[model samples]
Target chain A: MILCDIGNTYIHFCDTYKIWKNLPDEINKKELSSDVYYISVNSINEKKLLKAHKNSYNIASIVNLDTPYVGLGIDRKAACLGVENGVIIDAGSAITVDVMDAGNHLGGIILPGLAAYTQAYRSISPALEKRINFGMDFDELPLNTQSAISYGAIKSVVLTIKEIVGDKKAYFTGGDGKFLAKFFEKAIYSEMLVFNGMQISIDKALKKHKEQK
Target chain B: MILCDIGNTYIHFCDTYKIWKNLPDEINKKELSSDVYYISVNSINEKKLLKAHKNSYNIASIVNLDTPYVGLGIDRKAACLGVENGVIIDAGSAITVDVMDAGNHLGGIILPGLAAYTQAYRSISPALEKRINFGMDFDELPLNTQSAISYGAIKSVVLTIKEIVGDKKAYFTGGDGKFLAKFFEKAIYSEMLVFNGMQISIDKALKKHKEQK
Candidate 1:
């Protein structure tokens, strides 16, 4: 069985312990012979894959989790499912901070990612335009404009995450997850968190189908 | 003496206890006989005002403070000058958080203002676009997208300030000063902080001119 997570840019596939990615256009050229379960944010790409492959399932359709948040992204839902009790952080194009306790999604907040933080500063004024130093020391206040903005971006996000997570175990995922996880006293960095979530959802769906039969 | 703070959108004039604003275009139509001390971010408008009035002085020239921060805004310099020790927050197009202690400028960081925060979220994705509810409760994790983004913006900013200002008093100024000051246990909301800084600079400049003679 193969699990997939499709974003606007890339279509990621995970089979067992192996993971690979393909462009949306590349989906039509290759034949997906095995059963593929996928969750996608890109509807157009999802439709194209659905048309090309007969043995494909949109995992988002089957994944069920307890969440009070209305219109929570399927990707976030999948990530939350992988953890029973922890603060799940998905730091991609946007950084999402979700809290889960006793196997239920408590809710979450969204912050601009590192790139988005840089873009936000640049958009405010030309003087504020500076590259964010992700590795800047948060202990001391920055004395220069570049360091100031950089420290602001990194520190603000770190503080927000720390405030929300509290004593709960933190699970970090996505592109910049490892970088942010370094600041925490203890955080689990799992690259396949979303994929693991997809697997869990697929398992639950299959079990439900079997019980129905 | 008349004091003016020129920004991109509006020209704010403070005369003693009275304060008023004028559009950039309206400055030429009005005749000014009084000596105006002004700090401006708008160069064209500053030059135009300079040409129109010979008695006008750019207050940025006279203000002297101890700090290592480079390219700091004149308005921020003036705000810092108003307080002996405190975290000065200027919430306008961009929210600036500066730490001042015992008459020395310790440096500061900048974050996107409330409006900029909204713009940042909207720019991330179409689905993420929502009006930020500024008054949302921060104690609980937000269950809806609107509250989530709003809470994230407010809570992050508040936490950053709280982290930096620890035991020091907080001095809030600018357009959204009063609103943000409510979050802190004890904070001074001074509308004339920048103007006061300008006045202090003018007094110092006059004293130096006397000493030279």
Candidate 2:
């Protein structure tokens, strides 16, 4: 089976051995020869992807989890469902840190990612428009303009996540997940975490469909 | 005598009895019958203010503080000079947290303030465009979008300050300083912190000038 994750910008397609990204308009119907499971945040692209594959399934409807957070994104929900117990950090455009304990989502907070951070600083003053120094020393307070802003942008987010996760095992995913995971002693970085969630939901959906038929 | 703090937007003036602000262009030389001592970040306004008052003294040339942080703002330096031992938080357009111990400046970090934070979220996605909920409970993980973003913006900055401050008294100033001071156990909100620093520097300069004479 093929797996897909549709975002605002691109549609990511994954098979058994390869994963590639294409624009929503570039999706070809003739390419899919098997069942496809997907989760999407973009409605228009989701419909296009659904039309490309006759057996396409949006896993959002199938994935079940306990969460009290209203308006929580499906991507975050899927990541939580991927893990039975742990903290989930999806460091994409926004760094979302969610706490999952024994298959239940406790709650989470949202932080702007690196680009968003840079934009925030630039908006305050043009002099503060420096690239985030990810490699700066976190142990000592920064003593320079670049390092000071860097410490604020990176350390503040890291400290917030650290305080929340505590001793809980943290599961990291998304583009910047690996970089963030390094700050914690018990962090697991998995690129396929969202896909893993989609697969679980697909399994449950197929079983329910079979029983009904 | 009069004290003035010139910023990009306004020129704040303080007398023994009252305080008022005026635009840089609205400054009148004839209105200043007494000596005016000022510190300014806006160079063009600084020149304009200096030309307006013949007896005006820029306090940036007088205050002495031991700091290793290169390119630190003069306003921040003044705030540090105002206190002998404490953490200084100037929460204006940006929240600058500085660590000063026993008359020595350790270092500081900068975070975007409320307006900048709002802009950051809006840039990420319009759905995230919500005013910062400063009243959100810090102890609880947020269960809604607004609270989640609020917790991230406010709590993250507060926690960062908390970890650095530890047992030190925090001296808060700037526009948003009063709101942030509530989160700390030992915080003093002072509106005249920068002016206090300017006073200290002026006294020192006068004593030195008398000794030379």
lDDT of 2 by residue, A1-213 (tens): 889888755687778767777789898666677888788877888988877777988778787777899988888887888898888998877788898887889899988876788888887777688999888887798788788888888888889899889999999987789999999999999888777777787788899899999
Superposed by TM-score, candidate 1 places the C-alpha of residue B91 at a distance from the truth, in angstroms, of: 1.4
How many residue pairs in model 2 have overlapping backbones? 0
lDDT of 1 at A29: 37
Tens digits of per-residue lDDT for model 1, A129-164 = 899887787778888888888877888888999999
- What TM-score does each of the candidates earn? 0.89, 0.86
Where is the poorest 10-residue window by lDDT in model 1 chain A? A24-33
User: Scoring each candidate complex against the real one, what DockQ results?
Assistant: 0.71, 0.67
Q: Which tens-of-lDDT digit does each residue in B55-160 have in candidate 2?
A: 9888788877789999888788877888888899988777888998788899999888766787887787766789998778878988988988888888778888
Report lDDT (Cα) of residue A177, candidate 2. Answer: 90
Candidate 1 per-residue lDDT, tens place, B80-104, comes to 9989988999887778899998898
Off by over 4 Å in 1: A8-11, A20-36, A42-57, B8-10, B21-35, B42-57
